[model samples]
Target: MADLDGDFESAESGASETYPQQCSALRKNGHVMLKGHACKIVEMSTSKTGKHGHAKVHLTGIDIFSGSKHEDICPSTHNMDVPNVCRKEYQLNNIDDGYMSLMDENGEQREDLKVPANDLGREITKKFDNGETFNVTVLKAVGNEAVIGIKCQTS
Candidate 1:
């Protein structure tokens, strides 16, 4: 019985650190889960063609945290958290063909750059948005892409 208790603790501890396996339970009704390495709200659009023709919103975010981005269509009446807490300034050191080197705030150098445009579901990939800082939610070093869920910071 002691061994069983120990195993239960270990399993619960591990589960605590990772994201929930089932994505359906994360968001509320009318909201669909966008998938990536780490998913975020990409876009949410709605039309008034139905019987109610209710208002809708288009939400677009990145899942660079999970190395992906996705789009979802939901009613515009919903509210969501636009989490940008992972912002740490990084410097563009070098660009080799398609790859770019990024130096983070800690001065840690990371290579293996893949353009955000190459992301599977990412639709918009403008040239590093002028003066916009990008956060590397997931990078390419661990068999993922160079970056994911990159967006410009406001204030």
Candidate 2:
């Protein structure tokens, strides 16, 4: 509905979570999207051009957050989606019932986030139980965020 004041709200909401890049340009130890999951490239190989036409790029990557492996094959000239990954540090305020209360450098706090179910998550839980202070490193990409690393805070 149009208002008399002609006011409208725009929501971008990270519309471009990923960008397209030629498969030939992708490199080892880089980031890419395979099978609709954001992953970190671990191995890549290109097959020589054959009767099939353009050379085929074979990619093998591990999911950034899930740790599951994904494989993909595409023409070298084809484009692949690359996730825009970022990391931030947050202070560990508290953990209640397997949920984390985290505060960022700007002092903004977020609660009720479930602890990641992985090795890093276990380490964070163990450290917090001992009354230690540290900052957690959060990795964000494609609308997904996870606690990936930790830095001990010195008082």
Candidate 3:
């Protein structure tokens, strides 16, 4: 019911008078707003039951530190809120061509990210994975890479 882009808040608003807050993960049948959570999208899949059934989005994510996997079902018709902030925890897979390749706990490729050492401070070559270690920060997504602000360690 909140003001969204233009007045297209609901798909059935033109002829219907009621709005449902929850939606199904298939056939785009439901709608709801979501809040931000520190997680990364590890995998995504889509499917449908039959010709008359709706489509669904299967999403898999991993907790940045705990490395626990989280799954969700999102309907195709659902008006989900894409979080403005993106966060990820990964291991220093390797560095090449002024870019860094990181392997997330889920073993997903989060690569080709160019992060400046000065931005991370202290020549951060730490190995973090399998509950060994991890870092958290707000990420701004620009194209394929993310711009992160590393919190400076205080003495």
Candidate 4:
């Protein structure tokens, strides 16, 4: 139907763009999608050609949020999808009921978000004091937001 086609076209146009990258192009400390999980590549190795006649790439990474190790192997020429990730800094405003209220540099308050489960997050949870300013890293990707790290702002 014409209406269905129009709606499909609009949805397709609104989708985010992703580029295919060769396994060899991936590097340590880079982000990659492995097994449908966004992971941070912590280690990578390339193997010489085997009887199959292709260099193989082995990657080991941890889930960005869950911290679970993920490992995979593929031919060096294989292509993979890379996720769009962005980091922004926010100031800590308050913490209550396991949620953090943050404000950007422009002083705009963001919706209270759950604290991350990393070491930095734990530190914030135990040491938060109202009115203390902190520099916090917010990881944004694919409509997800998370606090990755936090450091007290030095006077």
Candidate 1 per-residue lDDT, tens place, 30-124, comes to 22334323345444444554686645544455654443456655454543333222334456555566566778768899776554555432422
Using lDDT as the yardstick, the better of models 1 and 2 is: 2
Write down the lDDT of every candidate, Cα atoms only: 0.44, 0.93, 0.47, 0.80
TM-score of each: 0.34, 0.87, 0.33, 0.81
Residue 108 C-alpha lDDT in model 4: 95
Give the residue spans of candidate 3 off by over 4 A: 1-36, 49-51, 86-155
Question: What RMSD, rounded to one decimal, does every model reach?
Answer: 9.6, 3.0, 15.1, 3.0
Between candidates 3 and 4, the one scoring higher on lDDT is 4
Question: Could you tell which candidate, 2 or 4, scores higher by TM-score?
Answer: 2
Candidate 3: worst 10 consecutive residues by lDDT?
A: 26-35
lDDT agreement of model 3 with the native: 0.47
Better of 1 and 4 by lDDT: 4
The sequence of per-residue lDDT tens digits that candidate 2 reaches over residues 48-121 is 99986999999999999888999999999999999999999999989998889999989999985688888888
44-140, model 4: which lDDT tens digit per residue?
9999999867999999988776779989998999998777888889877777777878888888998668887678777887667545557788887
lDDT of 2 at 72: 97
Model 3 Cα lDDT, one tens digit per residue, 29-58? 121222233335666677876588668767
Query: Compared to the true structure, candidate 2 yields what TM-score?
Result: 0.87
